[model samples]
Target: MTGPVRHLHLTELRARVLSEDPAALEAWEALTNHLANVKRAREKGPRGFEKYYEACRQGLHRLSLLAGIKGISLYTSRHQFAADSKRAGHSHPQTAAEMGHASDRTAVTHYGRRVQGRPGTPLPLPSPEEVKTVRKKLGPSNGPHREQK
Candidate 1:
């Protein structure tokens, strides 16, 4: 939760969150709090809290990186992006996430494989019996059907 920037073991984490950048600081605060809670709750052994906590940590890291790169926190940058997108003609979009300029379409895809051991069911390899029909369809190389030969 505490990054290389230092200033950990704060006298009060919640208070620090209030004074810091909301989006970036809040994310790290959430991650730190979730970790603390999970550590204490683990006596029951991985009751699905780990995944949610991990998501929080990932979100925090993402927001922090974006904030550092853009010299703006996620909260402000998102607002600015939205305002710009709306002015550029995406005014009535339902979610703020949907507000993007025409040329600024962003696509996110989770390209996971669908193999047997994979997340989705995988297709089986063709058996010898399956390919026997392929040869029949084309016929023999020197057969009557092979007119060019």
Candidate 2:
């Protein structure tokens, strides 16, 4: 784990940087070190990370345009992480904890729905007899409004 990092709203948020290549971690360390030592590059306002956040947003926007990928943003990573976690068989609570949510409801309601192909048993389809029975009980439909005999 690395040192404490600040979020956009100047709140403390713990984040784990995962990378397959050692060079990526090395670069991240170097960037953090550089930022720590240097004077504020932008205006006096905004926490250091916030300034960088804007820069990243602009840079990513330009890069996405060039690559012809629409709607790419920083939050995309978060969504992807949630989806990946779910597909990897993580429980809702586990994913919620990792994502810094207070309860599993947020993770299950929002993040959990992001998994493209959800795991677990498929819902059982009603048999033809059951379908007929239900249809008979409901009677014939007259659009949205039911007719009174």
Candidate 3:
């Protein structure tokens, strides 16, 4: 990621997203190209970035609903990424750098936990029917709620 990030002024971070899946890289490249064109056009201005981000957020929400997850926002991915980095044995400073923090305090304080055994792996979503059955067992409310108290 290059350019001025929200944190730490106009400093460029050294972190790069890597994946063994070629399709993931291809998709990222395509998005990068599109974003470049949008920047060049300078038509949308500040709203252009927001428009694309909202589209991505909505896409993720739809995908989560399809997978039987009630809510999964873009911020949730940031938390997951931080935890995954820690689980993968990254140091506090490394995690902070990847997260674009000037210090490790924010990364260590907020995201990730001390875990044992091997690193965590992604799990496939439960079947839709299974989700339906679980929801049924939880009653019409679906599950617990803070407002219930």
Question: Which structure among the candidates has the greatest TM-score?
Answer: 3
Candidate 3, residues 47-147: lDDT per residue as tens digits? 77767777778998999999999868987866776666566655555455556555555665676453521354331222333322221211232211111
Record all residue pairs in model 2 with backbone atoms less than 3 Å apart, i.e. clashing.
none
Clashes of 1: 0
RMSD of each: 23.1, 17.0, 15.8
**Candidate 1 vs candidate 3: which has greater TM-score?**
3
What is the descending TM-score order?
A: 3, 2, 1
C-alpha positional error of residue 39 in candidate 1 after TM-score superposition, expressed in Å: 1.7
Q: Estimate each model's TM-score.
A: 0.21, 0.48, 0.51
Residue 18's lDDT within candidate 2 is: 60
**What TM-score quantifies how close candidate 3 is to the native fold?**
0.51
Residues 36-119 of candidate 1: C-alpha lDDT, one tens digit per residue: 876666654666566655665667668878777544333443454334333333212111123221111220111111121122
lDDT of 2 by residue, 29-135 (tens): 76576566434643465466567777878989999999999999977766666665556555444444555554445544565243353343111222333223221
Q: lDDT: which is higher, 1 or 3?
A: 3
Candidate 1 ranges beyond 4 A from true positions: 1-19, 46-149
List pairs with backbone clashes in candidate 3: none
Better of 1 and 2 by TM-score: 2
Lowest lDDT 10-mer window, candidate 2? Answer: 5-14
Q: Which residue pairs show collisions in model 1? A: none
